[model samples]
Structures are given as C-alpha cells and as structure tokens.
Target: MSTIVFAFSIFCGWLIFDVVKHRKLTLESLVSSLVIAVVAGVFWWILDLFF
Candidate 1:
C-alpha cells in the first residue's frame, strides 16, 4: 500500500513537472500515464507482498 502510494505520487509529480514545463497537460498523456502508473504500482505492491 505504501509502495503503491509512493509510486503514484512520484508519477503525479512527474506529470506536474511536464505540465509546468510544457505549459499544458494533454488529456491523453495525463490519463494514459496515470493509468499506467496505477497499474504498475498495483503490480509492484502485489509482487512485494508475495516476495
């Protein structure tokens, strides 16, 4: 749970940085990256729990 939260937070920070640097946050990139990050985080959590 902590790992997932941390991963999501890091991804969100990266997204925010990109938005600030580009002066825009495209819907596609935002949604896609968010989804990817969430899925990756979940997987990481599961793996950590098992191993």
Candidate 2:
C-alpha cells in the first residue's frame, strides 16, 4: 500500500512539477521533480515507521 501510494505521489508530483516548470524534459524540472519525490519518499518512510 505504501509503495503504491509513494509511486502515485511521485507521478502526481512530477505532473505538478512539470506544469509549474513549463517544460516536459529539462534539467531544472528533472531536478526539481526528483528532489520533491525524494523528500516525499523520506517523509512517507518516516510516517510509515511511526504510524
């Protein structure tokens, strides 16, 4: 369940990031999406461990 949620979050995050960035494939958007995803993953992991 967590895995599925995390993957969905990443996909959603990427979509939002892509829109905000105004580019489908660029270094900045890629980095921003990755960073956001990673942060979200870590946050999810912490939540899973705690709750």
Candidate 3:
C-alpha cells in the first residue's frame, strides 16, 4: 500500500522535475521518468523483501 503510493509519488515527482527542466512534457520525458520511477520502486521492493 505505502510502497505503491511511494512509487506513484516518485513518478509524479520525476515528471514534475522533467517538466520544470524542459518547460514541456513529451512522450520521451514521460517514458523516461516512468522508467526511472519503476526501477526505483522495484529496488525498494527488493530491499523491503530482504530487510
């Protein structure tokens, strides 16, 4: 539950960062940010499982 929320927050936060940096949103930016967020979420999940 919290992990899911955190993943979404990461996505949103990354998207906002890209938007601010580029001054626009595009498919590339969206996908890149989403990929990064997913990777972070997966890493966090694995860590949670271990510890």
Best by lDDT: 3
Q: Taking the candidates one at a time, how many backbone clashes does each contain? A: 0, 0, 0
Candidate that beats the other on TM-score, 1 or 2, i.e. the better one: 2
After superposition, which runs of candidate 2 have C-alpha atoms over 4 Å from their true positions? Answer: 1-12, 15-23
Question: On residues 1-51, what C-alpha lDDT tens digit does candidate 3 reach at each position?
Answer: 757777899999999999999999999999998998888889888888899
> Which lDDT values do the candidates have, in the order given?
0.79, 0.75, 0.90
Name the runs in model 1 displaced over 4 angstroms. Answer: 17-23
What would the C-alpha RMSD of candidate 3 be, to one decimal place? 0.8
TM-scores, all models, native as reference: 0.58, 0.65, 0.90
In order, what is each prediction's RMSD in angstroms?
Answer: 2.3, 2.7, 0.8
Clashing pairs for model 2 are none
Candidate 3 matches the true fold with a TM-score of: 0.90
Deviation of model 1 at 49, angstroms: 1.9
Best by TM-score: 3
Residue 47's lDDT in candidate 1: 84
